[model samples]
Target chain A: MARLVVLGGGVAGHTAATFAAKWLGKEHEVVVVTPNSKWNWIPSNIWVGVGQMKKEEVVFELAPVYKKAGVIYKQAKAVSLNPEGKDTSDKPFVTIEYTQEGKVGESEDVEYDYLINATGPKLNFDATPGLGDGSGQMGTNTVSVCTAEHAVHASHELEKCIQKMKDGERQKILVGTGHGTCTCQGAAFEYIFNVEHELKKAGVRDMADIKWISNESFLGDFGMGGLHMKVGGYVVSSKIFAESLYAERNVEWLIGAHTSKVEEGKIEYELLDGTTGEETFDFAMLLPPFSGVGLKAYAKDGSDITESIFAPNGFMKVDANYDAGAYENWKASDWPKTYQSPAYKNIFAAGIAFAPPHLMSKPMQSPNGTPINPTPPRTGMPSGIIGKAVAHTVCDLITQGEGAHLHEASMAEMGAACVASAGKGLFTGTAAAMTVYPVVPDYDKYPGTGRDTKYTFGEVGLAGHWIKHVLHHMFLYKAKLKPGWALIPE
Target chain B: MSIEEENFQKNDNFKLTMLPGAFAKRMRTCVVWQFIRFMVLNIKMLIVVSKSH
Candidate 1:
């Protein structure tokens, strides 16, 4: 029987493992290796950060669910890939280090017929000084809601700041990217607004000064060069929508900023204009830049093959047009349709683990020659979709034999729905529920914005708020492998 | 800040493109008006999605 080993167990890895197990079932072996013990519904981490939701509500033990799904779940972090096996054996195997209780730091080599690298990102906190404790862990200078634990910490910090505000203290709140090359401007957008919402609810709105700082060239470039949303009958640009939203909410912004360094209550930043400045805040939640989880790959003779298997950023190289050149020349075709590795046919990558051909936004470099651009966003809906598609291709190859057709899911051909929460409440809350057909801009197919305007829609109101809340529950339930879980769309 | 704005936006080869105002009027609100209008829009979207596949 063919053995399939999947690395990482985020949205991408979990989806791939479960689906492959179900499809292959008892005939082929499916193993999932992830460092985390719990599966987190990451989108709801915003609510958790604001104390709107409990950490338990967003996470569930992954082991039990994998057990029910008939997939071998290993609580371990992948260390290296021996895609060409060793001099002792011709069989390909992966080196994994256990992160679970008791077996922590222990290593093992497991053989695999096929490997799916969905190990996600390492949350490169070291990319900037003071973002991390100089050793890849988040520092105390700022709080983050990128992880469930980080969200819990952020929630407590936010509470303390609110208390200070209520006690006659005028607190400055800064929220956005921790570094220039960071992505997920959307999360920070949702977060800053949610903080505003929470402050208003706490009756300390007037006491707190909430400000946004981001790496986006424009206000609304949520990475994919800022999409145009069809609001009501008008095809309004997201820039105008975001600008008006910020103005209405009294939220001031500094765009095109690369936060260079962080210290207690202060941060030094470089703007796109080559100007340097500093901002101080009582509470800051900045997203650090992302990099590959640093998995090394070696050949049969133990020669380093990491350069051939991975990009400089350490993300696995898939079937993508890496030589797409400049922003003006970038095409949607540069995105991977079948996430197969060009070097090893037995390996594939999906989600954040895969190296995108290039940044979705126009790449920019500061006058000092430091590149400060928003990286491509691969989260939630897109990650799960890519994961499932990769799983489908892998299962077909394993079950139906070598000549079977591979399933393809291209970012250029798929649509994504994002419900960015501004607040979390039944009737009082609101979110911008946006739908973009084909996340990647297809300049050849649609020209201008490279999007089909008819299908790209967005609206903000209580309905969106309710929908986001519903999605939180639904996705968590699906992740838990509840009855009728497979019916839920990625 | 001013220089940063000039640096980022000023060098753009194409002028900033704005969307048509036909659908703009319906966008600006959050209370009862937005609630009713957006609910209808949501329903219409649900129908569109259901019909698409």
Candidate 2:
């Protein structure tokens, strides 16, 4: 029987492993290797960061779920990949170091017939100065909601700031892009608003000065450029919507900024227009840039095929047209259809682990040659879609045969629904529920915005917030492998 | 519905704003015309103010 090995157990990896195990059944083995024993619903970690949710509320033990799914689960981190196996065999094997129980640091090589590398992102906080200390954890200075544990810590720090504010001490709050090339601006944007919401709820908003700083040339440019949203029966660009939101909320902003360094209580920043400045803050929630988990690969001859296996940014190279240069020249066809790696037919990448052909923004560089543009973001909807698509392709190759036709799901052809909460409320709060067709722009189909304007609109009200709250629980329930879980989309 | 329809339904009073580049050349001609008018007005104003002085 062929063995299908999946790496990491994030949204993409878990979806791939669960679907592959169900489809392949007992005929083929499905193995999942991840460093964490608990699966975290990362989106809810934002709530955790704001003290609105508990850590346990967002994370659950993965062992029982994997057991129920009939998939072998190994709590280990993949060290490296030998796509060409060892000198003795042509079969591919992955080397993993265990992180569970007493077998910590113990290594093993698991052979695989097909592999899905949905390892997600490395949370490369160390890429920026003082962000981290190279241990894959956030630094002691600033806080992040990237993980549940980090969110918990950030919440604690926030509580301390709140207490200080209660004692009549004014606190300066800064939130947004930590690095110039950071992609997940949406998360940061959500976080800043959440913090604002929480502070206002605590009655200490008057004592806090909250500000946003980002690499986006304009506000609301959530990686896929700014989209036009139909709000209140009026078609307005996200730029205008975001501007109005910031103005109405009294949250000041500085766009086109590149955070250069982080010191105690302050951060050094440079703007796209070549101006340098420093912002001091009592509390900061800066989102770090993401990178591949730094997993290396070697060829049969031991020659480093690292370049062949991965993009320059360390994300796995898939079937995308990497040479599709220039923003104006980019087409929807540039995205990969099958997600199969060009180097190895049996290997595939999904979610943030897959290297996008190009940035989504109108590629712009600073006068000093600093490439300051929003990196292509493969957020929740796209990550789950790609994961399921990869699973389908893998199952077809295993069950039907090697020549089985692969399924196609391009980011440029799919639609994504995002519910961004302005504040949590039943009837008193607000959220922006937006739907954008083809998360990536398809210039050939929709010339100007590259999005179907009809499908791309946002409505802000109490109902939108309710949708976000429901999505949080629904996604977690699906991740837990509970009853009727299959009914949920990947 | 098409994007135009969705947009129109969302905001009945909203006017479509074209990209700045599309009318840049035409806008330059208008700017020249406005500049001549401003110059003539200023010259006339100067003459009136000088006579009053």
Candidate 3:
């Protein structure tokens, strides 16, 4: 048999196609494709953007969990990467399209003797200018919980700004990162403190006004360049634990910034000492900014090798050290331990679909130059431990053949464990949780805070909102392949 | 008064005057000290998931 496939079903393509279809069962042939037919659990889409969960409590229906994990789903949407096939099929394939329901756009191809990609990111909401809708989605004048129907349309625009602050009026709101190389500023910092804990649980927290905006040059450079942590026993420094939880919840910040534009309630910005401003609001959410969901590729006489498989901010290109230039010559061995694809060693790439080699924060700009930092986040628990270490090196190179041995996880040798939350009360909630360790920061093996301050610490109230509501029902019961779901780790 | 609101009013007056009683603020919803800090933060997140695999 020998097939594999797997493209994008989020959370690192559904943890590498449900652990490579339970380690290649039924003789071999996994499939997957993915154009979403519901799977979501995205960090509880920040408690469904504050209407406190319910979008069927964080999605599920991935065609009956890939028909009980035998795999072969394909709700489609890949579009290209013939690897080296067509000059009349030497067999590599990919193509895709569909998007389900009566084969929406219809187009196929399939083939593949191993190939993973894990096609994440592409919420590039038109990169900025009015934060998208010039055809790349989002844009209805700001709002996004980053799916789950944009967190049920950001809990109905934060319930019409909490019924216009229960009729008294005074709204404002805003949140963060619409551009300037955004990389999930911890999901807009857990959605602006869960919209200030649901406008102080609807008592209209003194008529609204919220704030916070990002691109982090400071205020907890969450994009990894700010770690130290520890907290209650002391240590500290995620910019003083995120400016002491946005000043003990009065919530207000701006940080380096960059936004640049977005109208219909105003925005614009610039900062990093270059000035230029504007801020108005009444409600916003922001986010967007992540590329590579483009795909393309080809070759075997098909010509276009799509810039030798991706990156120019389109991801893919794997096996790191992308000319590890500047930023004081970045190291921790320029990441990527074996996300493979150095010209297709049966291809790989997991999570935000690969490409990195730089920017664990510390890259700023703006003096009219504008670069504006913050990019490398590769989401939650290092995208499920680099999608189960690229599905254990493609199931040991398809059950030990071309000399196996390639499972390495490397985010400079793993270790991550966030929590975040900040509101969703079972007795007035809150959260933070945290942990760090190797998450890339080695500085020549732990010298001056390149992590491991005793597995980096952090902590906050109601037991981190009951461990973020028991990791939102234990990662949606380990992504619904339930019943012990391989003892739920990644 | 803008350098990001004077560095957010100097980190809100450096956390209301140099961490006076540095946060415990009522043992974070007390419920028996947050149920013994929710079992020591789930054994420190299973020892960082057993040292990340």
Q: Highest DockQ, which number?
A: 3
Better of 2 and 3 by DockQ: 3
Chain B TM-scores per candidate, in order, are 0.45, 0.43, 0.29
Cα lDDT of candidate 2 equals 0.81
Evaluated at residue A346, the lDDT of candidate 1 is 85
**Using TM-score as the measure, what is the rank order of every candidate, best first?**
1, 2, 3
Residue A400 displacement (Å), model 2:
1.0
Please state the error at residue B14 of candidate 3 in Å.
3.3
- Each model's iRMS: 7.2, 27.2, 8.8
Instruction: Report clash pairs, candidate 1.
Output: A233-B23, A234-B23
Angstrom error at residue A325, model 2: 1.6
lDDT of 1 by residue, A34-70 (tens): 9999999999999999999999999999989999998
Q: Kindly indicate the candidate among 1 and 3 with the higher lDDT.
A: 1
Query: Candidate 1, which segments miss by more than 4 Å at Cα?
Result: B1-53
Give a tens-digit lDDT track for model 3, residues A311-338. Answer: 8888888889989888898998888888
lDDT of 1 by residue, B1-53 (tens): 43234323532321233222324323433466666766765665554433322
RMSD of every candidate to native, in Å, equals 4.7, 14.2, 21.2
Task: Report the poorest 10 consecutive residues by lDDT, candidate 2 chain A.
Answer: A422-431
